[model samples]
Target: MAAAIKLASDRGVSAIELVFARNLFSLPVVATWLTLAPGWRAVRTRRPLAHLSRAGLGLGSMTLNFIALAMLPLADATTIGFSAPLFATILSALVLREKVGRHRWLAVAIGLAGVAVAMRPGGASLPAAGLAIALAGALGTGAVNITLRQIGRTEGVAATVFWFTVISLAVSGLGLPFFAGSHDWQLWALLVLIGVSGGCVQICNTASLRLAPVAVVVPFDYLQLLWAMLFGWVLWATVPGPATLAGGGLIVASGLYTVWRERQLHRSHLPATPTEL
Candidate 1:
């Protein structure tokens, strides 16, 4: 998903074009599920404010992410963006006052170290602008994840996604005047493909989490890096250096450890017989 977004941006496509394309592509599947899924009527929520807030966060994260993609290699962009989960863990402890253990904090430190390695200073000649944008995107995405956790308790995933699409479309549309321009057929197809693939990825992600434990599934999310690398090399011919590879490994390890700790915490809080939806 990140690769596709960056590819479109590299081709000089606007963020609005990318966002609208994703929405249009995912519309069919979203519409079908919303219409035919059992208990679809029960998914509506009364928390309009929460929905709007989440949607705004989503828009900010995605927009910043697109900008980062345009400036950074796909693998680098994705690795930096992956820091969101670590940020979420730290923020949860600070803002929500959740109890965080030393082990988790250590994991966060290691993850940040990895990010630093990947984003070397003037010595290694890394793109500071790209790293900065990726960091901003990660922070925004972390906030969105925290907000989603709060809202998820009262709203179904479908309802959350629905509001996200609506709000993101509306907000991104307003920015059209700034970046909007003409596009060729190829650009149009790629933009639309981004939108459709993003929606499908979200659905798959939700289902994957429901079907398997986070400890089991979160590691696979790293596969996105492989995809990003492949796309970056094959399409853009951007190969990562030694520092990037090492830093990405550290990030993945720390991220996986953090996820494992989170799952342990969640299981500790829940009852023996988990409640079914």
Candidate 2:
């Protein structure tokens, strides 16, 4: 994803234009997969409004995150974006009425502190606009997570992915009139690669949620920070500063602890199986 965004930036495409390219190219492939695998009926849902809301938030999240990426260092953008899980925890408490223990609450605070550290207040290194947009994108992502949990109870992964893609395409297409411009063949190829890889990533993400509880799977997502750093260094010669390393470390640790605590709580509530005489 970092590479794709860099390619878009190099190609002189606006964030919205890249999003438009991604959805426009991805729609047909997603539609074809839906048709062949589960038939077109797989896209049907009893909750069109829910899907629409989720998609709208998702599109907003993607646009903001991409814009942040374009304007900020990859490591900074990726590290700050890690706050999404923290936002999700808070949203789950508010929206789903889920009980959050004191430990998790403390962890959330620590995670947020990490974000503050990374922001490096009064520092010249941070891009204020990019950081703010990245945080907003993370909040949008958290909201999307809540909606996905709600709709995932009855919606198949195929349907969820397909509907979101359709909605994203429609919304992004609306920006075409204002942002549309020509790209050379190489750029076109890169855009197609971006779209395809993005679809694959979405599929994997949806599949992980389906196979395991979010608490069990989400901690692994922090791996993105490493990938971001690598891509930043290799492609743009951007190095991670002390603030990024320190703050990102705290955030990742706090998030992992929260996931572990959730798993322990879940285990304690399960009915114990016994084989002893």
Candidate 3:
């Protein structure tokens, strides 16, 4: 995903334009998914409003995170974005009314401390706008995770994934009047790569939630830091400093602990369609 973003930005695509391109080109892939899953019938929903809400939250998360990536070093941006899981823990308790024990509560506090460390108050080097925007994106992502868990109960992964891309396309289309421009065949090919990969990522994410609870699966997100660090280094010759390393470690620890506890409570099954959901 970061690689696509890097290519898009290199092709002189604005953040919103990339978001637009992602959804626009993604239409074909998602349409294929819908047809294979049985066309319009797969997307028939009892909760249009819920799907709309998810789309809004998702749009917000993607836009902000992309902007942050453009603004900050990739490693730093990814580390800060890790706060989403902590936010998910709190939202799960408050919104979903899921029980959160003292262990998770303590973990949240520690995660915030990690964020603070990564931010390094009064740090002249990092862009404050990037940090703030990334944190806000993470919060929205947390809400989106909780929302997915709620809707995933009755919604098929195909339906949930399809509606989001459709709605996002509509909302982001409004920006085309401002961002309208031309791209070469190379850029068009990159857009196709971005679109198809983005669709598969969305499918896997939605499917994971259908198979496991939020706390059980979100820990896997920490792997983004590894990807970010690798992309940053191999592409830009960048390496994260001590603060990013320490803070990222703390956030990973918190998420790993949550996954461990959740697994102890519930053994997850990974069938294509979960009978339980």
Candidate 4:
């Protein structure tokens, strides 16, 4: 993610271009693997509308995130984006009718406070366009997560990923003629690397979810912020301000608390002993 952000910043690539590059390069590989894999079949959906909606939201999220990366400091962009999980929590309560306790709500509020700290007008003074892009990305991500939760019971993960890539590629391709421009070999290589890394991140994320529950994996995501800061400094000499650091720390802490609370809830609902085990 940090590498992709650096590439976007350096190349002045548009969000749509980065998204197109990602899906154009990665989807074919995923589709081919799915085609060859045993027991693979076309995803049958009673609710095609829901599937399409989720795919659209996913594509929008990716596009907005790319735009934010291009426009904001890597650390600030990443930190602000981390608020997506909090948005997801709130959305899940409203959309999924999931019971969210007071504690979780408090955590969400605290996390948003962190976001405010990072985005305070005089502190970092990130361009309004960048802040808007980041917020849009976070909201889009929350929508995608809610839609995924609604349809996940009926759709295979690979199918969902595949369709998202298809939608993203199609949408971006439609706009490509307007934004098309030539790039040198170096920029092309960076774009390729971004695409590859994006694909690998998705694969790794899927693998992690399969290996462990989401609560176990989510906390590790905070490490991305650290990586973003490091990459920004090393590559672009972008050092975050004190307020940004404080805000980022609060966001990470709140996120970790949310994960921990989720784990506790999961454990509480489990039977005292597993009959199979």
Candidate 1: residue 87 Cα off by (Å): 0.3
- State the number of backbone clashes in model 1: 1
TM-scores for all candidates: the values are 0.86, 0.91, 0.90, 0.87
TM-score of 3: 0.90
Write model 1 residue lDDT over 31-68, tens digit each, in one string: 66677773467447899999998888788788788888
List where candidate 2 sits over 4 angstroms from the true fold. 35-37, 210-213, 266-277
Worst 10 residues of 2 by lDDT: 210-219
**Local distance difference test, per candidate?**
0.75, 0.83, 0.85, 0.74
Clashing pairs in model 3? none
Best by TM-score: 2
Top lDDT model: 3
TM-score of 1: 0.86
Clashing residue pairs in candidate 4 are none
Q: Which residue pairs come into collision in candidate 2?
A: none
The weakest ten consecutive residues by lDDT in model 4 span 207-216
TM-score winner between candidates 1 and 4: 4
Please give, for residues 33-121, the per-residue lDDT of candidate 3 as tens digits: 77876677888899999999999999999999878877888899899998988888899899889888887787788887888888878
Q: Each candidate: how many clashes?
A: 1, 0, 0, 0
Indicate whether candidate 2 or candidate 3 has the larger lDDT: 3
Better of 3 and 4 by lDDT: 3
